[model samples]
Target: MNKSNIAILVLIGILFSSCTMKKETMPPNILFIAVDDLRTELGCYGNTVIKSPNIDQLAHDGVLFSNHFVNVPTCGASRHSLLTGMRPISKDYLRNDITELTLTNKQEQDAPETFIHHLKRNGYHTVGIGKISHSADGYIYGYNEAPSTKQELPNSWDELDFDYGKWKSGWNAFFGYANGENRQSLKRQVKPYEKGVVNDTGYVDGLTTKLAISKLNQLKKSSKPFFLGIGFFRPHLPFNAPKKYWDLYDRDSIPISPNPMIPEGVNLKSLHESGELNGYKLGEEKASLNHPVSEQYARTLRHAYYACVSYIDNQIGHILKELNKLGLDKNTIVVVWGDHGWHLGDQQMWGKHTIFENALKSPLIIKVPNKYKSKSVNSIIETVDIYPGLMELCNIKLPDSLDGKSFVSILEQKNMQTDNVAYSYYRDGISLRTNRYRLTKYYRKEEPTIELYDHNSDPFESKNISNDNKEIVEKLIPILEKGNKEIFY
Candidate 1:
């Protein structure tokens, strides 16, 4: 290596060594919580209608990242990127089965298997509950099939578990309804939303919370520092929550999506027909890309989503309460992340799998227990950056093959000195999200293939201004291509 490169490496080594020395006495435990398909519309993110008081309180107490995007909008791929500290280089990285197809049933090797495995290798006992990886309970199984004996991340967790409750299996609990039935078992003959008149333990997320709380009690008594991962499935499809959470908001109080129409000047490739949301065969409305859903039906769906969000928020409140009650809150590094964002009728789309802002930007909050105060980061950061950032937080040596950079310095400084950008890939499109602009390039043909939306002027992404801003498009294409490690299929 050149002299300057060698010197930089030496400096980084010394810095990491110092952090290691600091954590010798009492290494912080991590309470890594991942929520499935949550958007950035919480009260903390400036949404006035949603009742996410607990999440808002956490944002008040921790650092809130306003511009957090995932590498891909699909669940498994996004979580894989977060675990491996890598970005999408090929079509395999874009699939929702990336984790199960690659990591499940694989043997542990010399290098750490994932960020969880990294913690396990460094003397930390890692425990995972619910869907930390792609599988609902970290087990490999089809949505319509019986639960299998396979574990998703065999090397990552010392005690990987999920309480299936009455649903019987991981996939059932994942696609489960308020009653014992699930969409898979019912053959998709169910409605898209539910407001069951039951208690907190009515839904699967309630049971997941109960399991997480029980695990926290056991972990507090353990001798070793623990890395507890709690994953909650909520605000996803078949939005099911207790009636109490649904009662938290009036139907009219919930607002409709501001940008429900397709942005002008964009081709048909940029739009989706909400197929995932329509998979619940008995839904009242089938979403269309050409015209938005009826106004009242849109509000009802948003209400269901709001109720689910509040339900998960309440579950998270219970977990954090137990953490503080056990006195582990002071020493635990808490991270609450949403795997990816949902459209919620934005841009006439219902689910993820698009490179739109709503699909890619999710909620991210980190509390390092006095390491950093409550702050907001507006600069863009992708999900791949999270794995290395966690390693740095725990004083572990980051793997050399990581495509992400630790945000520890950004946390310490509360500012972005680097060129902070987030890149996302989906459906033959590569999108770059910066603080001010979103530039997207699609591989489809026979249309105005480039799409650009200036966030500074139009945060809702109402129109594609690429033709109007040729100078900005030329300036950003090279930067976007540099981050694409494309191993074309």
Candidate 2:
């Protein structure tokens, strides 16, 4: 009687314990990839010229947003707003360089909270591979350190030293005084070398990708969730990539920009007056138009940019492969985004200072495992939304101070509307890109001009329809005024 009773009791206890034990659910890992100065010139974005097979494949596999823009166009300002989930207008970060933009030195230390910090607090191991937040304090931003407990990646540029002065100014060896005056400048200027060249052995994009691959491999064995930020610095200034990439495109095949030269008699007085176009030195219209940049040179530049993009994409593929190999792809959320769009000889402009669609739009791709797959969202989304979107995707509590709303619903539905208008502000101009229209208003007292483009009819934004469509202008004027009144911080 005693043996039978004891055996029955033990069996009953074991069954009850099995039913009550809590099953551990691992939190989804995040693969955050950021590219510097990348425009919507990829194959997925309908640019037939640039070769971005890896990125195009990613878009095909995941959800790609047709219209995505950044808070600001510059690096530091854009990154600051992106990390803090605030607009450049709100943070007063109107320009590059954190020290010059943020007034107080202590303000840098007590800056707005970042999504990375939030992830770290939520038991996720945060590791920033490269160019995450300008790397002010090495420890805070994860620079000059080995990969975390999550993974290990070899540092390609750890031993290399960068000569910023020689790189930017291009003097053989220039020395500056204590007051920041140039003491001596050499006569011969050093030519800028492309990446993968012997001189550019320490390319930032290559180094960053190498490190990221290492981290991805190491994270395979970790039990804790990880947030890996892989930032690629490419297609920016100094246009650097491997020589092979430069040879990918045919010289004559490289198409010239539709509006390569600015029209004659069209007044650029406003741009010149604003001091914004100060150093960009505009030559005579005839000279500028007649000066022949050989097809070879044009092809070379295009090839370099495209090659850098491919390089980044290859690295991304490597990381994604590692995730799949580690059995993490099922539980991981991957987001690939470019900071802002770049101009390739559009409106006679080369860089991204202007508020054109080519300069504003960015590539935004999100893959949320089994939940959100094979979806394409055409809604206009701002970079600010990334902060809240990540929080919602991971089911993490978002900070109340964040100004962005989670557009997680848009990921499911192709035509979901989170906001009626997506806003982008430059120094004195505010651009409101709605579903079908884009309106830009210059806030100059003397010459407050308005430029409007009906994207439905004019996707290329060639004609300024503001003057012609007076009725539509009247309809959108009130909305634009209201948006201008609302602070974007």
Candidate 3:
């Protein structure tokens, strides 16, 4: 063989090796951020009133999903679906507190080998902060606390600097009451607002943000590829935040709900009439109205919620900036999502647990580094899709039992159709949302009552055309049937 031929072969081999190394090194690190009970109420999601600059900026940098619904609206069910990559109905697990659900034979106690466990097993340093599970208390989920192990309590709880008895964090403190039904007990303990103080001064969201920042700094120094899940507990309930945040907005300026005042003679569904407000009841309808909230009071509550969101956004911005400073932004994939939407006075409701869009629709923002930059996807995506989607984004080998399909194709192709309908189920009710239509069937076996709304025509879902268009209903019935078959089977 000639020396020239041998040299040419060696050059080709070097080029191939370089290309392979580049491809292998391209796998980006993931920064999965999950918020509790947040709705699609930001500037990016066409919410002009709410101030979420951090989230809006993140959306501008990457992709903001227009339509992202959770499998279930409640905390436990939604998180279970998101973590496990399966629908709540399919798993037959729809309640909070893994222990109670398991004891009552309602659902399984352990998480079904979630994406986090998968990542951990595959050599990613996984750490969860704040409320990742139904319970804010970590012991409920088998972390840090065990009968055989010594309990190393944080200094904050030991010193009793904060009102541990009243707030979720404080409950393990001096005044902790695990069985208490009234959340107002904690609400009453919070000081209206104070400036420049860390201990017992700010809301839980602020505390969570501070802790998350600390975690980020610690993780940055570590050599391992980390999966940090920072869960923010805010805009959820009690409507508490720093008084300054509440003071930011004028009460009268807060916009009234798009569908304010539930219409007269609107059919009372079993969900509403059941009198369970899905778990947390702000108050009875008559009581809420009789003690009619003044415009000032309404504004105050809305202002607090908005302030909490802004606070969260600010924290997120800080984290993102840190990621950039550490040169991790190039390899980190950031996903900011709300567990479910909250009802800020829509249909006379104030909390999640309803099957309405206001309650079920959550904001899903994904930043896939240099590879997937400045892309917006409008495909129908469920919370269950998050697991597989992350798997594909990180190029991880996903398990075959995953119920979700990766929407990575949709990221590349804007108009990709992963599924014809995004299905969501709550107890007996099932909802199917498509590009142009939303059809919901309330019951099984019996003639399923359907409500059809053309999303393009009526974005607010004001008018139900199910009764008016018999042919459309008939046509959609089979589609709904097919969707349910997949959802249940």
* Best candidate according to lDDT: 1
| Model 1 Cα shift for residue 374 (angstroms) | 1.7
Reference-based lDDT, each prediction: 0.88, 0.62, 0.64
lDDT of 2 by residue, 248-331 (tens): 676567776665554332234222221221222231121123343444544555565676676666667777777788778887
Candidate 1: where is the Cα deviation over 4 Å? 1-24, 487-489
Task: Give the C-alpha lDDT of model 1.
Answer: 0.88
Give the Å error, residue 473, model 1.
Answer: 0.6
Residue-pair clash count for candidate 1: 0
Per-residue lDDT over 1-489 for candidate 3, one digit per residue giving the tens place of the 0 to 100 score: 899999999999999999888745755667877887789989998877777888998998888988899878788678777877876544356566432343222232233356776666566777666555454532232322221111111111111111223344422221122232124455434322122223322455455556656666776776666777766666665444554554556656778677644423234461243122223343323214213344454455567678767667777887888888877887788999999987666666556776767778999999888765666778899998999988888778897777687888788785499454677777567778888888777765544256777888877666677777788778777877764654444
Alpha carbon deviation, residue 341, candidate 3 (Å):
0.7
**Which stretches of model 2 miss by more than 4 angstroms?**
1-24, 98-112, 135-202, 263-297, 446-448, 485-489
Over 4 Å off, model 3: 1-26, 98-112, 141-201, 263-266, 270-297, 444-448, 483-489
Can you write out model 1's per-residue Cα lDDT over 406-443, one digit (the tens) per residue? 88878878557456889899888889998889999887
For the record, the alpha-carbon RMSD of candidate 2 to the native fold, in angstroms, is: 7.6
Measured on C-alpha atoms, candidate 2 has an lDDT of 0.62
RMSD of each: 8.5, 7.6, 7.2
Ranking by lDDT: 1, 3, 2
Q: List the residue pairs that clash in candidate 3.
A: 29-331, 164-170, 164-171, 165-175, 171-176
